[model samples]
Every structure is written in structure tokens, then in C-alpha cells.
Target: MQPYCKLKSSTRSLSKLVACSALLLLLDLSRCFSHHTYEWQDSHTNERLVCKQCPPGTFVSQHCTRDSPTICKQCPKLHYTEYWNYLESCLYCNVFCNFLEEEAQPCNSTQNRACQCKPGYHAELDFCIEHSSCPPGSGVAQLGNPQQDTKCSQCPQGTFSSVSSMDPCRNHQNCSAQHLEVNVPGNRFHDTFCTACKISKGSEASDGLEDGSGSEDCQDAVIDFVPYEIRVPRRLRRLKRIVSRSSQSSKRDRKSLEELQMELHTYLVQLKNTEKKELLLMFITAGIVSQSEVAPFQISAGKESLQVRRK
Candidate 1:
């Protein structure tokens, strides 16, 4: 009985050891199954656990992990990443700008380099634009360079420019004259230059018409005789009477004053009568001469004739 009891005890111990060993084996299997496995895949495989994250500026379509079939995708061309740990995909870069000197800052979800425009280029919705030119005569030409201009110009001759940002002037077509009677050139308009007429050629009362040559008429010299003619009459006859009196007054001064006085009075009376007749004769002669000169053909004709009648 003792020996049988010993064998039974040994068998029970062995069975317990076997059961523990089986339990240990099952735990080991469970641990082996629970631990993560690394899976390196070609470009198209997908994985679940321990999947890699996509890189910056890149998007991942699938999750990839260890030891399973994984889809490991590279970033598109022109793309880069800062890190590589668990990176599911690489990012795509921005399009290249030929005219820009430097990269621009990133925008939106895309991780790209910013593009900077060169000098003299303005930024417009992802593009660089050139500046516009100002119009002539607007006074824009006087401005500094690199200015964005819409118009430019200069002032006319008659008019002056006040603003710097002005367009050039249109040709002045409406020039004006300074005075009347001056032949101002026609077709002067729109701020054309103004000119005065020649001093001698223009007058306040003269007509505005221009002759073949521009000149003025000179004034003629004048003489006056009618004012002096009527004041002194019979001057030559009076002088002739004085001369005759002087000639007749000979050497009888002291002897016979009464006789001398009588003779002088008589001579003076005769001189006055003679002077009156001479004045009548002067009027008659003037009348005759005037008539003859005015009517030379009206003189009556006469013929000298002698006739003897026989008895």
C-alpha cells in the first residue's frame, strides 16, 4: 500500500508540472502575438499598426505599420520634409517663379517656399505686374522714377500748370489780340501765343484790315494865308503917296509958314483923291482879268471899215 501511494503521488506531481508548462507555453504564445511587428513595404503596400505619418506638405492616402503589407509613398516632385520618423508621405513644393529672387512664405496647408518679386514688380494674385505709364502733358514726367502713373503732361504757353500730377496740355488754338485795329493772325486758338501789332501799323481809329504790306499813311504839311490877307489893304498905294509928299517938300521951311501949310493941305487932298481912283481902277482891272480868264471865247469881234457913198 505504501509503494502504491508513492507512485500515485509522483504521477500527480508530474501531471501538475505538465499543466503548468502548458500554461506557460500558452502565455508565451499570447505575448508573442501581442507584441508589434515591423513591416517594410514597397511603394504600394498598406499597414495598420505602427503606421508612419505623412511628411510636411505631403498627404498620405493609407496607414502603414511594422511587418504588415505597407504602402510607403514618397512626396511628389519639388517637395521636402523636416523630419522622417513615421513619415507616411513626402510633401509637394510650390511652383517655381522665374522672376522672383527669393522664396515666399508658405500659405494654406501646403508647405512651400514663398516667392518674392523683383524690384519694379507689383504683387497681384500670385503674379508680378509692371507699372503703368502716365499720359503726356499731364505733368507726370516731372515726377520721380518708379512711380505708378496714370497720366502726365505740360502746360500751354498762355496757361500755367498748377498741379504736378497733370497731363500735358493740348495745343493752344485760341490766342487773343491785345488791341483793336491790329491785324491779329487768324487761327489762333486754345492757348496759342499772343503777339501785339506793330506800333506804327495799328491805330485806335484805323480799320482792322491789313494791306499788301503793313504800313500807315503820313500826314501832309499845311500852310495858312487867308488869315493874314484881309488885315492890310492899299499898303503899296499908301507908300507911293508918302514918297510923292517927301519929293515935293523942298527948301521953304522958315519963310511963309501959312503958304507952306496951304500947299501941304492941297497936295494931301489931291493925293487922297488919286488914291481913291487908283483903288477903283484896281477893282475894275481885277474884274476884267477874271472875266477874260474865265470866258476867253465870249469877246465880241469887230472889223475896221470905211464907206464912201457917191451923190
Candidate 2:
């Protein structure tokens, strides 16, 4: 019984000693954190004392001793110390701005270099990506900045975005205001295409301007952007005077020219009487061909339908 009692007392003392040691260790850690200490021990007396940390933009010139505090000196140019530290040297400004990046913040004693993506580009992860353009049927909802990507939205009804760009959608054209017929209706991707109806006597569409200038052009119809070479023959050579140039012209010049002529002849055959009159007038005005040069064809002018013969 005596031996058991002694063993129990020894166990209790050991447990108490362990608890005290743990409490002391926790208190030491809390004190170090609250005061931000760098504790140093004297080798001879085993005495420990806290050393002061250098502030930002500075470094420790010398460590603390028994009688003196930590010696500090301001960091040199191009060196940085962001926080209170006992570091022997400051860090270098290693970040550099590339072509796709711009300097947002220059390197200083307390901070390092900072970079951002250039205009028309947005940062993603570690790289800069060019802003994406909206498609034909869509438009830009929100433009992008250095930190984000471009946002796009579908074009709404009665509006159209004909081209892929960062611009917003535009309203469709009003055909009635132009005194024309809606040949093709507008949607999200394309504007309304208009065409001219035949001008009859006492018709509403024929009420032209007082200057009498509305009959010639089909009432300002949307004519395609035809190239000069495609619309008129070039006066380069004998072949050029007949038809425009093509890729196969070099290999089979005469045959291709004849084929192009046949195609033009077919188109002319398909044109309406009013269109034929307009074509003849255009040719006469532009000096491309003469009235006598044209073959036999029928045309209509205002109230009269006239037939022309080669003369």
C-alpha cells in the first residue's frame, strides 16, 4: 500500500509539471505575437531579451545586444521591405511590364512593381487576352477593362447589328419613309432591304421631287458596291475593252471573255423593261457605250413604253 501511494504521488507531480510547462509555453507565444519580439539569449547568463524589428522600407543594420537595441538603416534605391522585419537585406523589384502590360505602380522603397493589362486586353490568370468582338447577330453589352473580358448580348427585335464589332446594335431602316417597298424584312443580323416598284401614271410611289430627279435611280435603291472593273470595261487592251480581267484570263483569254459576255447577255435578257431603260441611260451618261451601239431592246419612260432598234 505504501509503494502504491508513492507511485500515485509521483504521477500527480509529473502531470502538474507538464500542465505548468504547457501554460508557460502558450503565454510565451502570446507575448511574442502581441509585442512582435525577436528574443535573443545571452550566452553567459542565459538571460533572454526581446529585440526591436525594423519598420517598412528599412533593414536591420546590426542585431541587438545586452545594452543596445537593434540597429536599423533605410533601404537603398530599388530595394523594398514591405513589413516590419529583422531581415538583413531588402528584396529586389523583380516584376517587369511587358508589351501587353502597363506599369500600374512603380517600384519604391516600401513596395514592388505592379503591372496591369494594356487597353483592349484583359488579364486572365498570368496572361493578357485580347478582348473578343461581338458577332453579326450580337452587340457589345459592356465594354471590357484591364481586369475583365468584354460582354456581349443578342440584338433586340427591330434592331440589327450587321457587322461583327464592339459597337451597339442600330435601328432598322424605315422603307415607307423612303417611298420604297420592303423587298426583304430586317432581323437581328441584317437591315431591311428596299426595292422600287413600277412607276405608273397617278401612282403614289411616282410623286417625285419638284426638280424631277427621282425617276432615274429606281428611287435611291440600295445598289451594291460594284467594283469599277466589274461595272465598266478597262481600256487596257483589245480583251480588256471587251470584258474585265479574271484569274483564268491568262490561260483561256478568248474563251473566258466570251463566257463573261454570255453571262452579261443573259443578265440583260432577264432585266425588266424599266431596268433596260435605266441601263441604257447609265451607259449613255457614263460614256461606256452609245445608244446606237446597243442592240434592239424595249424600254419604258415615265408614261410611254418605247421600243428601240439598233441605229
Q: Note the Cα lDDT for every prediction shown.
A: 0.35, 0.60
Each candidate's number of clashing pairs is 49, 0
Worst 10 residues of 2 by lDDT: 220-229
Candidate 1 vs. truth: CA RMSD?
Answer: 45.0
Candidates in order, TM-scores: namely 0.22, 0.56
lDDT of 2 by residue, 70-100 (tens): 8999989989999988898999989999999
* Global CA lDDT computed for model 1: 0.35
Best by TM-score: 2
Best candidate, lDDT-wise? 2
Clashes of 2: 0
Per-residue lDDT, model 1, residue 239, is: 25
The regions of model 1 sitting more than 4 angstroms off are 1-78, 81-87, 92-94, 100-102, 106-110, 123-129, 137-311
